[model samples]
Target: MFPKIHALCAAAACAVAASPAALAQQTLPAITITADPRADRGALTVPDTEQAIADIERIPGGVEVVPDTQFKNTPAQTVKDILERVPGVFAQPRYGDDARVSIRGSGLSRNYGNRGINMSMDGIPINTSDGLVDLFEIDPTAYRYVEVYKGANALRYGANSLGGAINFVTPTGRDAAPFEGRLDIGSFGYRKAQASTGAAGGPWDYFLTASAQSVDGYRDHSDGKEQRASGNLGYRFSADAETRFYLNLNRIRQRLPGEVTKDAALNTPQAADAEFERLDQQRNIDSLRLANKTMLRFGPATLEFGLFGVHRHVMHPIYQWLDYRVQDYGGFVRATDRRMIGGFHNEFAAGVKVHNGAIDTDQYINLTGGHKGNLAASMYDTSKNLSAYFENSFFIRPDLALVAGGQFQHAVREREDRYLSDGDQSGRRRYDNFSPKIGVLWDLDPDWQAYANISRSAEAPTFDANTFATPTSSDIEAQTATTYEVGTRGRRPGFTWDVSLYHARIENELQCLTTAPWSPCTIVNAGRTVHQGIELGAEFAVLESALATGDRVWFNANYAYNDFRFDGDPVYGDNRLPGVPVHILRAEVLYKLPGGFYAGPNVEWMPKSYYVDNANTETVDPYALLNFRVGLAPAKQGWTGYIEGRNLTDRRYIANAAAAGVATPASALFNPGSGRSIYAGARYTW
Candidate 1:
């Protein structure tokens, strides 16, 4: 087990650093892990959260583990609500469950849907085979903990995207409570409820959870409702062997307000776009996932394998009516060995993954009230991907280790157009690439460490870009980048910090460059670009007990500095990237009593406005938000509750913006943030 950060438990300190929402409530005393009965469970198939954190620390780059306890008191409804405290991550909600998320400048060109990143659950890919993520499928309350691997550090998962990967780990019956329930209600007619139960008996374990939520949204035409269910069953043949099965289902419906002009976004922030309201735009989806995994231990080595399948149906109405059905299946195998090699401590791991999927797609003319008219397009799309990766860490001395790894991937994309009206836009493309990484880690002490790494990343275009961006050609190339990074993390008596600096040189970067109104922007490959930034996360204990009342004061902050630009293009020259700002800062100060009650105020600030067009002719104005929370955190066993307020100042600011080649003041490209609101919740467990 890792050493404790202070008088508090290592688990509490690490969890606090990962989520600012938990910073002020650190009143739990340190406890020894050996006395815990759950420690003897199978580590390979289902390691506890502390073990997960220790494993993540072995990686020589940016990574974090966030326990669900850290955000339990808040309205854990969206990714932004749970992940916003992690440095180097950008998550801004547009409306309902949809958010524009990116890491270290990844997916800057994508305004809707996810790209340049990989998302998984229990090591199984949640993204479609062609690399698209639907945020609506994730239920924040279902995860036991979340693991974030930024950039090339995600080699363990065979991820090749520049943004790396995030894995949501679920609890097993051996570690969960027998029964748990929660309810949350907030402004704008928001409501959510969840129930879960788990148990273990005679080498058999099971866990199940279900949730339902609805929101009348702060924006017109943006209301949504969703339902989710997840469960897992595990069987142990012996102390060293186990197998588990998982099932997940989701039903979601969300109305789209669409984008608004800067003036409308800042002035009439609550109004929906006229065209979108007239057309009654909406998105609805039904999806199911099933998987099985097995693990076996062999003294000095462990082997794991798994297979997963997903089925989804989507109905979307915007400019047109889109109906699609997708079926995806894949499998992975991995092995890890730890032992002494030539009298030196060494650890090695290797894995291979294969993912394939097919989609039946249809588009029809749109009628009023989100009804379908005549058929506009029909196609069958298929994707195949295969990747193999390996990593090794060799200890040179008691306090130093050298790490090296690499991944090779082959991918194929094929589209068969069945509709003749669009003149058969069928096409085929293949991509192959190898990425390598090298790093050095030095332990300054038990509580501090420093590391440096150089790595490469590559990403292939998804079907979204392959189909809509190029109607008559199939020439878009893969995006690739080489990056150099260095960082340090440590904890002292009263402070903890994690910081990293990185610079990347990219080639054939994917970008959307179009100025047409009411049409999809065309994605293209840029000649060259650069992404560089600093990520900083820190927390400090301000006053231990100034009033002699056993109360404490804490301060927590996260700051990201981004500098992204095109190297030199004939049309745009060396202009700044359009989507993200240069500086983002979030900070909070809180007062806590020894009994678990805490109160705090926080702020989110963008110091300067950023451009919205590649030409740098138009910009989105900078803004700041003020919020506060007061809650009694959950203890060993009992009922807990919290009240939270957001945007207390009712600031009218742009929350998200899309990229364009050139734009005017009239361009409808910005999404407004929600106004002042309040939320409250209660939970009980036994």
Candidate 2:
């Protein structure tokens, strides 16, 4: 089916490219940025490469952007599926909808909550100071594009700058138009529906979108349902200045299919039976964001300023797993000034941020004879940061350009925790740190560039680790990393590619320790670790025709090699990082057909290593998977349908590993991936 789809799409793309009408429609008008609405009138079109370069130049380190065109028509189910195709990025799915993301060797020690990286949507930080970002709260359908900035490049966002940053940007009223809707259904009882509408009248423009999705799931106890709504209201004072307000709401109801043992995972990756009563989990999140951006022309310089705030609330029902509630409110103000000085173009930016939040969590412990012990934990944390940064680009002999920049930041954090057990309260803890970064880029020519940078980043300790009066103290020091990276991006007539190499050394990393076999796990501060790797990615146009109506064929691939290990004495041996796959590779080929048909085939491969059990036992082997998709558009501006198959080989495997011997000894240490599944869906756009 996938091969047929690809052949169809390839034929369509070639036919369109060859058609005189299609060639005529391919020409786009230039866009102008201005302060007057009248002056902003024109077709707003910009190449993906231009935006990618702009992001790279503005950031202090490595950065990558994935355009909407890359995944809009793919058979991907979640953001993890999209990101996994990118080199140096990996998603670790615990069970069903829960997943943890890691980049360039970072997030190796984080067991429960998000750590080492910052995630944001439209400039609102999704990661709490305690180092956790709930990936389940995000829906990929809402965003027009995704951007990833690695190492020090994330400094502009906030702390936890070491691993990197991910930003999801939604489409505006002007980009998506008046109304749009889509419905999708796939294998395993999967179904999704989404709709959005927007109107632009004079100076005011409003947009709203809603979505609902459900799946029977690949494994038992993994089935789930989700609903989400988002809105954006903006007032354009002028073309150069605008104020926008955003609101996001999400609810997820799911069942926890506890982890299985290595044997179970390997033998029955799609099994749903549970030894104990199945646990049900539900999560709710409501977030509001307001931001204002203004651009001003000052003599030979352009000045831009932005101010924004966010409010987030989360509730869950899994005490031992993660039954907690939190409220976060914060604001940031930043200004960037760009000007030409002494034949060099210089850009300077400075900002200050304040974050204050409170979290209350409860833990239940099962005692003998079905008795239960309840523990209540509460915490208050506040963080303030001040930073100043500058970057300069000098054009040397037209064909060659040099870019350089630096940043200085000062941060302070304070925390206090109270525990109900023993009616004890932990004293307030205070911490402060200073971090810096520097980088340089050289454009060898129009199609080639070389860049290198070394930056420092840090992450604060979380409340659970700090408040619980366990033998292992939670007063862990902040973790820091110094990373050096070199990379390049370019394109030829029929091919494009990007590659990078990086090395990082971290201090005082946080490692979670679980009680062997019968006991639960806890968070702890480990000594030191080192992460180094190489990433290579590229895309090529395999076939093209100008005489046909719409016929084209393309291939895309990504590969990464990661080498991670302990740098100093730590509780655990210098074992290869548990979840970080040493080698990851992905490739796909897509084609468009003349009759508006499309098809594609994609493959993902990962070499596995030791799977750690609660008793520290190891499960060793490797895994590979394949997927295929086929689709057709009955009319140019009407209905489109698709059919997709996942795990075509029906190979069974484990997606996660943890200690689970005592409770469900036979299946306590593994979480299986999925099996071969088929799905079909259709959409109508007007």
Candidate 3:
């Protein structure tokens, strides 16, 4: 089915390459138009956080811009901390920096690494060409802000996945402190430190930062350490042209505690799977990336282009000792035009991305203490993908707009099995799709808006999902869905709110269901499924001038309701999906006094239990966690301190679980949550 479609796409590409219309469009002049006049248009090549937020709010769907200031006063250790207030995003830590992050129930099948979502740093792809993400390599302290585009609204980034896209924007010399240092210490032998410096002079500007952390995790056999460094250099040729070069490096080592039974998870929360300790399971990675971005402003449009390359090496030891070396490279070009068309306000954005990568894998029998005994298998895998996307907004009325967009993507997956002992498992697959979107936006007032959109999304299976017993799982196919969404967001004098409701009808949904304990899961295609949910985010000023002249009481909360289940399937009819909880709520209240001081209490509650298998026989329990924190806001040139306590009640509960086809009580599928702990930190800038 995909090969035929891909052939048509190839023909279309060739025809467009030789068309006169394409040539005429390329000759048009470039113009610079911005929604915010305060945006820096001269020296900086990228918009600042404030300008970015202002621009993102114009989207006709779910989108968020999270600034680093929201988490700088607390323990900014993981994605969970940085995205805590963002609705529809579920990020939970398993141990150390390793986490299970999903959006709108996307990637709920795979238990390791990240899938179903596109991750980027500084507008460059961070995931491999095969769509696998190494979460441990992401350093939370290195970013100035993050942008999240939910579902098909991420067409601007050429992402056509169910979960959409996340971009981490780094700080520039102009916005960064000249010199800064920070230190953090916490329970369970956790410690971290960071240092940074930035400077701009004449036409040259630079920013550099490095961080290191170590943790003896809450569970046994879950100790880990990591170090990272990132920097960028920018050069300005004129007021309308600029170029920047970036470098990033990471070294990580983590111990795998493995999953435990439901009984052990709730009773002996600190216990590690016995097999994991005996085999000394662990994962270590070394990676480096180099990238370059340039911006050119012509007469009426803005053109941006960039290229990047990454090298990653992994050493993983579990039931089998796996060694992998990967190389990936990509390039992208984007254009934006904001001008009057037919005397109506119009905006158009278009982009194309090309990514290719290869991986060399070797597997061996695991010996005690993470040593290799005998060679088990060897294989080589390669992937290539191309994506082109465009979006246009045309004002039909003074306060109303119609938005349209689509993405065309093509991909090729191939594998070569060097070890013939594994039945010569070699194959190739081709996949392609054209996803379309249409939406409407109405500006209710100067500070409020309402939006509705109907869109389609598609995702091809990654190599990890395809390779268990063969080079490619013939039964595993691409997942596709059509979604309908409606939402409203606004900000009043003392209140802010963002709410969205969505429903998706999916076909051939990919799922990973293991059959045995501690066995690798095999990816399969589910016949049909339905995913529907609601996302809510709100903040209120409970009281102003409660204690002092410039003090206030603030209440902030976010909620997500997931209703995912099979739809008239031949087997497991109408059974709910097993990975995510039915309902999740997070809320906090803080009191601010004089002198940049604030204190807050927060709660994370999951009131309903969920199943862990397609049969819906085994279930996880529900629980709530209480936490508190007090801190002094960071000053430009002085020291600030903060202290936080989490899980004050020490509730024992399951944090994460892997799915299974049919589960028994003895099935080892649960990961325990952390116990009570306290953390403290200090920072200084000069």
Candidate 4:
């Protein structure tokens, strides 16, 4: 957390006047977290929009910073709740808060456990070294802001995955309210309660948040519960140096409703597979993470370094009683210099990151009543990655800058089979790649900017992607892509817009093929594929003077046009990729008042039917959903309340589908969407 400018200056003065020993021994006074009273007024919470967006725009590609105000007052339980309006981000809720989250179709083929997209909490990596992220481990209420770096824009963080990175930043003592509490109750036996607090004293600051939630899902055998907590402690050793430690824990238990046929999904939306109920199929996880970060400032440069460790245990029963324990640790260091070079402005940055992890896995046959039958097999899997990167921005003109950078990565994947019955199916592989990026940014004016960039990215196979019947590790190749993008973002008066066009040529694409729902999806390689999309977002005030002062109507909308297809494949030549829709659009008409009353009607429409297999024989129907929300948030000293209704038309739709290798209806690939439901919540702050 950063204090007000005055308080920071005062602390800096004291530090400069005192000797090192004296400063270390001094007892400082308590400091309240608040914005600088002397600064110009702006939107509440988070950094000022212009400055923050400027920081994001420096990446020269698709990037955004979504503030908490966008979805905080609603049922902020799922990533889809907030990400639905972000262009290029395709996230749909699965049974619970678990989502099929993908970026530009990066992980479209994955149905369970996340991949392609790197995830972080407050600048600390949350994804395992093997490129797997679990959405259930994240507590929606734990974050105050979310920073999205799409595609190669994430090179600064050593993220080479196709989807780039998502950083959920926590509130610090200087930014959070002293204490806050919230409770939410909704349809289908949903309930949630969360509490958070923050405090700062002398050189010490601390912030903590805890939440518990449960839901009897719309479909039978889909109930789930989760508990999560996160906190951070910080110390400012001097005006130019500071360090922070972060801790996070999660315990999650979720049931699997199992997929059904399209007819059964629409006719009996609440039905669950009988076998799933009999077997009591479920996925449960317990994970803990600890991390530390330190920042030190020199004359014209700053240095940041950090270390992190994680311990995770998973007890799940899907095709089999899967038990896995993961231990991962990593560290990173980064240096940044923002200074003038030979009469021109220059921003230079460089970093090195190392991450390694090992997994101890065991499987057993599922008997019944939460019991494991015979031992199936056992294996030990490990992964390690080391990367170095550098980037620099050179001002060619007062309003233009040229950026060039690249990263070199060395990684290894190994598996040791311990079960003799498995015939010693063990292997090891090494992957190395050098990705490069170059871009240019021109400040069209103070209110807008135009940018363009080209970059290369690479991703290695994960343990989950190695679910071959033979368990051979070297069978799959790393996925690679080369992308070219151009974009423009601008703000004028009461209107703002962000638009970009991008195309990527991918090789050795990791494609998933499944024959039956009873089995895990199989990973295979597709020859060459092309992914191109139009990502657009715009919002503007529609009415102001017609209503009361400071009261207005706004129109917000986001549209994504996906054109992903196979490039001259031998079998599925020129066929569109299965899974994601061809086009997705979301729009909202919102009315707001100065006293904090707001109401909006929103719609989500999938205009193009998408295929369910490479053969393109079967396809999911196109559908649209109508939703509405109303809320009241007076101020920090009062109660805030909201009412949200989703799928108000009670549309019988299939929200997502799992693709199969062989085209057939009996694949049990369709997951039904929830019917009409209403949710209400309230919160208090002091």
Error of 3 at 559 (Å): 0.4
**Regions more than 4 Å wrong, model 1:** 1-43, 468-473
| lDDT, candidates in the order shown | 0.83, 0.59, 0.82, 0.79
lDDT, model 4, position 241: 71
* Positional deviation of residue 284's Cα in model 1 after best superposition, in angstroms: 0.4
In the range 1-686, model 3's lDDT, one tens digit per residue, is: 00111111111011111122222232111112333232254334677765666567667888888776666666677888877678898888988898888889888867678888899998899999988887898888788778888899888889999999999988877678898889999998889999999888878888999999999999999999999999999898866788999999999999999989999999999989999999899989999999999887764578899999999999999889999999999999999877777877788899999989999999999998889989999999999999999999888775788999999999888888899875887778889999999999887866567899999999988886666354346547889999999998865555567899999999988887777765677788887999999999876667777677756676778899999999988889999989888999999887765466778799999999999998899988999999998877634567877899999999999998988888899999899999999999988878
| TM-score of each candidate structure, all chains considered together | 0.95, 0.84, 0.94, 0.92
Ranking according to TM-score, highest score first: 1, 3, 4, 2
Residue-level lDDT tens digits of model 2 in 495-531: 5567889998888766555444223355555567778
Top lDDT model: 1
Give the per-residue lDDT digits (tens) of candidate 1, residues 261-318.
Answer: 9999999999999888877988899999999999887776788899999999999887
> Between prediction 2 and prediction 4, which has the larger lDDT?
4
lDDT, model 3, position 462: 88
Query: What order do candidates take by lDDT, descending?
Result: 1, 3, 4, 2
Report per-prediction Cα RMSD to one decimal: 3.8, 5.5, 9.6, 8.3
Q: Give the TM-score of candidate 1.
A: 0.95
Off by over 4 Å in 3: 1-43, 468-472
Cα displacement (angstroms), candidate 4, residue 555, comes to: 0.2
